[model samples]
Target: MNIARPLIQLVSWAILVSSVFLVKALANDSTQNLSIAVGWSKPPYVIALNDTGYEVELARQVFKRMGYSITPVYVPYGRTLSMLKSAKVDAALTLSENTATQTIHLTDSYIQYQNVAISLQSSNFKIKRPNDLAKHSVASFQTATKILGKAYADAIKQVPLYVELPDQRRQVGMLLNGSISVLVMDVNIFNHLHSALEPIESRQLVSIHNIFPPSHYHVGFLNSELKEQFNRALNDFQASQAYEILVKKYHIFQEALSTH
Candidate 1:
């Protein structure tokens, strides 16, 4: 046997080992990059990509602990659902149980949203129950009817003037300017929007009635494995001080709104 034959065999083995390692490293890198869709721009939840709100930060931290990186893709509320169904994104954030379909696997609820019926204090609207909304000119965010449940949808349908707007800021302006008798939205969102108004306007114009119960939100994923992974990561994050720090950073607190 030629002595060079053994050396060539050794070189081939080395090349094969290196190729395998390279492939594995690339696969691991791909798995670590998670693409997620974020629908709403509500502050303290999702302010922007740079100033990512509390909820966004929470998700980021959870994924970070799981050895994954998050790429947040902003879209409208309705488009977020479509993207998940089409598998355009690995996951969608801030989805409710009512909004997720059977094809989508949802992670455990990580946050509770306090939704309220708000109007200008001057209007003196009374919304003790869903039925009370039937008599008012109402405006809400897109898909609010479905996410809020059938009772809300039915009651809103009876109103002579009911519209769903994509822009929460516009809804606030309409409520303040007498275009809508009442606006149904999360209390935090109202606070965020109200903060932008003039000092006197913020003080005297807006009022909120705690008519709706709190809604729990979750992340929706196309893959069940990813959903389970997120749930475990979320549980871990919740048990850590990092979660508390994020909440404080975003100023996510329940502040009593002045109601008539």
Candidate 2:
């Protein structure tokens, strides 16, 4: 009698194990099949919230529909590239065209924009030309100048006093502190943080008249094999209506669209 009872219990456990396996298989089948890494939120682009921010979220959804498991990594702009170089990450969310040419393989242009140097109104310094900066101190990130050029970078490096800030937001703070006479960064990044740092109305910041050409940003790939797969997926994503939805959802061309 006791042997029969033990046998029945073993049979019941086997059935439960089989059911669990079936459920796992079904779940796996339902999910897409790719692995990706998207960099942290820089805003209006790569957002790093618990919920994917606008553009990054769009990228996530686009890849998910195509079969991808996105791993979002929060990193400094410079570190983002380091990760890519080390193969620790697949691609950076959004980087300038210049960066693409200089660093990673870029996809077709998804977005483009002009970036400029900005300085607080209280400051007497004015930038008429790149050379005008010679007299004053500048706070800039090392990664930023790469987009500008080795010449610009060399010039910055040559300045009598140049403060290197790892974070763009910190550079803004440095501007306010009078530690540096000027701050150089993406215009959009400055605009996004300006309000939080100080009243936009109270402060007078100027964007130099000579524009930095509208630089394109796109999905990047480090490994060529992965790049090809992503390129195909990216093209497929572009052809789908989902792509348009993403552009609108993230307000990708906000600076241009806002005028309308």
Candidate 3:
């Protein structure tokens, strides 16, 4: 009937409309679910089971604004990287330079600071200055290696680094067990862990006053699509004063290590 060309055109238009609807529906579904990787323990920035833990709440609010339902996975800092590298997770709470994954995209600094060494209260190691640790063995996470390096020049001799602990609570464990003369950690994190993780004998610990290696913390994403969305959302958070509230809420950059 010589009607093939018109029929084909009509069919093509119908297919285009159907495809558009399908894409929109899929995108909508995706927006409702967001799964992220976070460490399982509390203290040093993230607290498990605490409604207001910095990393947990930050992830919840950030993703929620992007129209995503939050899925929080509790894992160690090292495993967090593994999850992102394998594309098993969508995002992570804290991103460090040590992670070194090519596929992971990072955003601007969401948190930043220096970590200090603390001794058990009985140890009497006063950290009143930076170089005071020239004769002590220091334990720290792998991510803290560079940060520690900036503080001590011949760091290998004075500051010995133990392997990264599974979580921040281990810093206290090492101190209690005498595995390390002192442990280096961000002050805010040190405080967070001090109050929430475990009950340490009050007389057994003391944190140094001197700070070391001022650093910045960042948020990370696995895919470019989510990365772009988070960056935009983070900017809005800053502009809307929510970032300030978060900083105060989490006490983000403020050091909480006062000799107690």
* Of candidates 2 and 1, the better by lDDT: 1
Per-residue lDDT of model 2, residues 12-105, tens digit only: 9999999999999998887645434454445555545674555666667666755676777777656766666677776766665665654478
lDDT of each: 0.83, 0.63, 0.69
- Predicted structure 1: lDDT: 0.83
| Ten-residue stretch with the least lDDT total in model 3 | 147-156
Tell me how many residue pairs clash in candidate 2.
2
Per-candidate TM-score against the hidden true structure: 0.86, 0.72, 0.72
Instruction: List the RMSD of every prediction in angstroms.
Output: 3.9, 4.6, 6.6
State the lDDT of candidate 1 residue by residue for 1-260, as single tens digits.
78899999999999999999999999888658878988768776887748488888888899888789889988877788788888899889888887666788888998888888997777767778888899999999888888887889889889989988767888878887778888898888888877775475446566778778899999998888888888888899999998888887877886846864
Worst 10 residues of 2 by lDDT: 251-260
The Cα RMSD in angstroms, rounded to one decimal, for candidate 2 relative to the true structure is 4.6
**Candidate 3 lDDT over residue span 1-260, tens digit each:** 78999999999999999999999999889768767788666553566675447667766777778889887887876677778787787777677765545677887776666666677767777676657766677766655654456555455356555445666677767765788777777677676666654565553446565556566666678677877888787677667676667768766766454552
Better of 2 and 3 by lDDT: 3
- Scored against the true structure, residue 37 in model 2 reaches a CA lDDT of 48
Of the two candidates 2 and 3, the one with more favorable TM-score, higher being better, is 2
Ordered list by lDDT, greatest first: 1, 3, 2
What value does the lDDT take at residue 9 in candidate 3? 97
